[model samples]
Target: MTSTAINFNQVAYLLITGASRGIGQRMAIETSRKFKPGSIVVLLARSASGLESTRAEILECNPHINVVTSSVDLSNASKQLLEDIIDKSLSKTPVGSFELAAIIHNVGTIGNVERKAVDMSDRQEWEEYFATNLFTVGVLNSCFLQKFRECAKKLVVNVTSKACLVPFKSMGFYCAGKAAREMYFKVLADEENDLVVLNYSPGPVDTDMTVDIQGRSNAEEIRNYFKGLRETTTILTTHQTTEKFISILEAGRFSSGDHVDYYD
Candidate 1:
């Protein structure tokens, strides 16, 4: 939980997934602007084009910041494939050369199939949700710790969902994955001391994904809930929420396994 002043002058790096849009993209840009000049940021996403656009925005904010883009479909990628990508990316500039400051698991999904357990076609949607939302965080956190165990200021911020704490009817799989993700990080916190883990729920921010969330579900309760968030303007935009997220990251004050919301 305790952290002293970070030496921004030192070479540092941040790895963030889902960086093509939403809070992930804003996090990259704002973090880069605050990091030491020439610090490196690795952006991971499924969209090469979106990653490029994010990189451009980041550089526009801090011209000296270095940006690396990795376009891979995490949903279907094997562990070896993910490991290879991490290996090559680290080798490009050497993890030892910089302090691996942060790893933000901002990638998650509500699943393409929006249905309750009883209505599910099979385990396909549940499995897919777990793969992207729950599985990847554990694997990437493991890989990151293996490579940067010596980084004294290592931080892991998992972009979780409040849905983990509360249940949603049609988003059963998503809720399950997020709940699993929270517990996974909590246990990891007990097992590791070299890094600080924060399970963060960004709340229901208005994004491209949320817009589509309106009618994709079979349940009227779930559909109306999402639609109301939009119609009533109850949601915060990604930019509006990034400040609080950055504050948490920069504060470096939370204990490992701390679960916090955006307003918290």
Candidate 2:
């Protein structure tokens, strides 16, 4: 069904991960702009300061928009910590404060995939990456669904990457984790009929992570590859990405379990 309305009453709350910077931060600000006055948005990230920055940005845009910031490190996280964050964010929320609107998995890491074979990848490093990248996505998603299943609508937006299909040289961790996440969501969508799951590729946004990729490896090919993308006109700004996502959500032309690339 082609949907194109931003009806705030339909949703009671918005939960956004990686809301500190890049596309995630922009999405939070823009979403608040569309939401009615006093709408609530919960920002989750590792850095308290980062979450605060996003909250400040949102409030600067709309002072009356209710903003909640939580800092939970996904890497090496404790399940209890995750539960606490959820409990604190929602337990005290007044009824009818905000339907759980959306859960955005915009947090990710470009692993230190230096020129090395997958077999030789450090086991500890692999665990750290998996814990945050893929594992946390599952945990947060499950928590959101369990907490807000009765809500009218719940859309799960998993931000995936081209790396899911195209493996970078020595970037096995990133590729594998994203590949797994894509399938996991596919299955989750099949199992949960009431939820909306969308795996989105934001394309080459000029974020700090993208720039770091250029210097992470000494391989000329890798450096050149990223540099090319960074310099090209194809690199999307955070605002452009926010606009695209807003359009998708507004038009309601999204489907669960499938992947959508920004360039597409």
Which model scores highest in TM-score?
1
Per-residue error (Å), model 2, residue 180: 0.8
Pairs clashing within candidate 2: 11-99, 12-98, 12-99, 13-98, 13-99
Give the TM-score comparing model 2 with the true structure, all chains together: 0.90
Best candidate, lDDT: 1
Off by over 4 Å in 2: 1-11, 94-97
Candidate 2 lDDT over 87-135, as tens digits, reads 6776676534555467888889977767465465578887888888988
Give stretches of model 1 more than 4 Å off: 1-10
Q: Please give, for residues 131-226, the per-residue lDDT of candidate 1 as tens digits.
A: 788777788778877777776677778888888899877777777788888998998887876667888888889877776667587678777887
All models: lDDT? 0.78, 0.77
Candidate 1, position 102, lDDT: 79
